[model samples]
Target: MPSKPLTTYVTHQPMTAVQVLEKAAEIVAERYFHGDVFCSAKATKDFLTFKMGGYEREVFAVMLLDSQHSMIEFRELFFGSIDAASVYPREVVKVGLEVNAAAIILAHNHPSGVPEPSQSDKRITSQLKDALALVDIRVLDHIVVGETCVSFAERGLI
Candidate 1:
């Protein structure tokens, strides 16, 4: 007698709205955060917005990239209150060095619906750019995610 071919079965479990959102975010990150897939400013903005847009407080993060500009990791380095987060250049540089990142895209979220880069934001970006420069890591852009996303590179702030 001939044996029947076996078939694999799969099941789909129902997920809540938050769980679905989280799963979608995970899929987006997996697709965009690897290889040179983050090739456009719009793509980067979308990824950063998804990652930081829902926060109630300030969150400072970096997208560590390899020499080929592929993402190495997305790290949230600092957390703070509604308006401010203490970003340390030394720590940022350290993380870049530790991961051997050749470039970085900085990101932070404003709790208010405003995406404008404040004077403080500008100053920190400048500081972080200068600090990362010493280690030969490029500062690609500084993105402020709020109601919309703002790119420092587009504004020529980087």
Candidate 2:
């Protein structure tokens, strides 16, 4: 969140080193994206899909944004097995606070390439929306990215 130089790993845990590097690299690269307003839902979807499209496993991520919907940081927060990712509201709120994010966009990949929100996805989106709202951080959308992206917002599920 803070504008510090990013290095790959800080913990001595048993996680995939390759994944760690990939996530860190994404964060670093995001710092240089074009300074365009991301309020357009269509553009937001395209951007999120671009970010998560190629992942083999499910990756839950967020794009931290300022009140004007400009980018602050992009994070790949949770990695999971082929079908699922365990999303934690607390950690998301922590990062939101860390970046001083005024709003957030949630996205995840479905390796099955279906691009549909499962029931679990809907449930978690509701939970996260409530949790973040408590901190006055609006949720712009919850996008499921696979072969394509499905927006809970467009469908009014958020």
Candidate 3:
């Protein structure tokens, strides 16, 4: 028997961690594109859950949307400790203006994996809603992501 040299093939580029995440986020965003109204609470929750569910600390993010509810951008605005984050409405409003977003879906992960909105969550949602309303921006939903996502809009909190 004759010895044969091993053969190998490289069909795709090896992606970095960040590149992989970016590609995944792009795919998630694509699911919301083919619609007149991008206001499906379940879909929004599902999408956000995939994006924010695996954090060890808290991450506050927003899905900025145009007037017709199409995506303008998805941004992680604040990073915090395992249990708490100081979410600034001014900064959020600034990004909304910068992106020219007409509405936003707020999300944050509970690293503890409970997915329950605490008192602070309720308070901030109210504050953010009122603050954004001042600038003619709408807060469509706030999703608390953990093992599962809990939606404020679905519960009539938004």
Taking all chains together, each candidate's TM-score versus the true structure is: 0.85, 0.77, 0.84
RMSD of each: 5.1, 10.2, 5.3
Comparing 1 and 3 on TM-score, the stronger one: 1
TM-score of 3: 0.84
Q: Runs in model 3 with CA error above 4 Å?
A: 1-22
Q: 18-38, model 2: which lDDT tens digit per residue?
A: 665456556544553445546
Which tens-of-lDDT digit does each residue in 30-142 have in candidate 1?
A: 77666677678877888877678888999999999999898888899999999999999999999999999999999999989699999999999999999999999999999
- Considering lDDT, which of the candidate structures 1 and 2 is the better prediction for this target? 1
Write one digit per residue (lDDT tens) for candidate 3, span 55-155. Answer: 78999999899988888888999999999988999999999999899999899999999999999999999999999999999998999999888999889
| Candidate 2: residue 136 lDDT (0-100) | 95
Off by over 4 Å in 1: 1-21
**Cα lDDT listed for each candidate:** 0.90, 0.84, 0.86
Q: What is the lDDT of residue 135 in candidate 2?
A: 97
lDDT of 1 at 38: 63
Q: Clashes per prediction?
A: 0, 0, 0
**lDDT at 80 for candidate 2?**
100
Say which prediction, candidate 1 or candidate 2, comes out ahead on TM-score.
Answer: 1
Better of 1 and 3 by lDDT: 1
